[model samples]
Target: MGIFKRVKHMATADTNHFLDKMENPVSMVKQYIRDLEEQMGQAQQALAQQYWNERRYEAQIEETTALIMKRSRQAELAVDRQEDAIAELAIEEKLRNQEKLALYKTQHEATKNQTAALLEQMKRMNEKYNELVLQKQNLLSRIRAAQAIQASTAALQPYDMDRVHHGLARIEEKVWQVEAQAYAGIKAGEVLNAAPSYVEQEKRDEIQKELAALKEKRGTV
Candidate 1:
């Protein structure tokens, strides 16, 4: 009972101190599994020893019983005082071994039961650990998706919008330049646009000389 009491105290730890050494959920779960395996192994070993002790106690009891029976037969043949004492001591030893054998059998069962319960606890803890692992993976996946979407949106946000505005402004300036060139040509004067050749100048001078003779004849007649 004393040994089991100490072990019980170690196994029953639940809060703060038990979790203080754990760094993360995965490491915590692994450590918990390891500790559970160690405890189960120890309990099983104790159970095995208890069974061996029971068997040895039984064998000793049988040997002592045989000794007691042989001495009884000898005492019946010769009623010696020392022989009677020997027979009585043999009976007491047999009773002691019997008691020990029963106690060991009980201890073996208790150890086996403790091991089984710990195994069940380990099973439940494993299920919980797996669930938490899945949750962490899902959260990571969602976070990645969210980051990608944010990056895409930022690329499309048009942060440097002045570039497009400047392009349109340059196009308008080119149109005004073309319009100004057309107006400038119109203002340069029509004479510069259509100058007569030397042959057209001679024809104009001959027509002016004929008009001067007609005017002289009309005045003398």
Candidate 2:
């Protein structure tokens, strides 16, 4: 059986899921460069194998050529001896070997073309990966500048003073309510830590009621 016999096994071999888990752009770019390097290595290895195969084919062709020439010389001797059948068989064997050799020659040419294309692709991938790395650094610097500017602007906002004063007013009112509730509980002869501020609630309610009564009185007038 060939490698990767099970279809499910092939899906796990891909690393896209793991690559997506990386949150940092710089780390992602670095990992991508590593993946490209591995691909480049594999392509170079294939090219080397093709180069070796081509050399083996060249040697095979030379060996076969020498063998044919030697047999042809032998055939000349056989013809002089008038052994026609033996010479015919020898020539036929040479023809078969030459045909096989030509097939290997064509295959070698195809492999050469494939290897050249792979090398070009590897070169392009390397260039693109380098460009991404450079761009990543430039982007990181700009991000830092943007973050610094945002922090500086937040630290120097005029509206922040209003926010602080509003918060302090809320806290002061809560403190006064607490004190009033404690005084009310003591006056009512209750053994309690505190209660809701009756005096403050009453005062705020009376003010609102008087404002409403004044509006009604003016409306009638």
Candidate 3:
């Protein structure tokens, strides 16, 4: 069987049914492309063999034709020498050669036709295989793009804005509490540092007594 016949069989198959039966369409397409490549290789080998067979048949035809011509000349020479027995023998040989030549010619024609047909089939198969490869790549790209979109949509679907807002508010409140504590510590430290010394307090009391005595002298005690 030739690859073309197999390709024809595939062409007639129900593609939608096949896809429905498959667990993964992408993997199936990949496998189909591989099969096409393998078939193409086989088809090439078969085409080469057909060509060789055609050449062999042509060589046989040519050799048989030469033999037929030689035998005919021998028969003519025997008849010219007046040898009936020899002439009859040469004639029989010529007839046999003619029959073989006819058979070879028929085989050559048939082989030539077959070779041409196989070559054409192989050419078509190669073209189809290339087309399938391109289609497989495009399909894979589309599948990837669809998966990415689906993933992105899934990520967005479960988002919780309220939860995020509550978390942020809690963090802000903690920051404010830390700031207030820091400010209170700074104010307390400043108050402790600003307390009066003992000498400064005694000078303040002496100034007050002098102001009171001056007031008494002025009869304004």
Highest TM-score among the candidates is held by which one?
Answer: 3
Task: List the candidate 1 regions with Cα displacement exceeding 4 Å.
Answer: 1-83, 156-163, 174-221
Using TM-score as the yardstick, the better of models 2 and 3 is: 3
Q: Show pairs that collide, candidate 3.
A: none
Q: How many clashes show up in model 2? A: 0
lDDT comparing candidate 2 with the true structure: 0.71
lDDT of 2 by residue, 67-149 (tens): 87877887788888999998898888878877877887787788788667666665665666566567568757977998999
lDDT of each residue in 1-221, candidate 1, tens digit only: 54455346545556345545656544564565565556556655665675565566556556655765665565554445466666566556656655665665666566556656555554544454455456556645776898999999988886666987898899999999999998887876555655565557788888877778888978942
Candidate 3 — which residues are off by over 4 angstroms? 1-4, 10-26, 147-159, 172-221
* TM-scores for every predicted model: 0.45, 0.57, 0.70
Worst 10 residues of 1 by lDDT: 1-10
- TM-score of model 1 (CA atoms): 0.45
Residue 142 displacement in candidate 3 (angstroms): 1.4
In model 1, the clashing pairs are: none
Per-candidate local distance difference test: 0.61, 0.71, 0.79
lDDT order of candidates, top first? 3, 2, 1
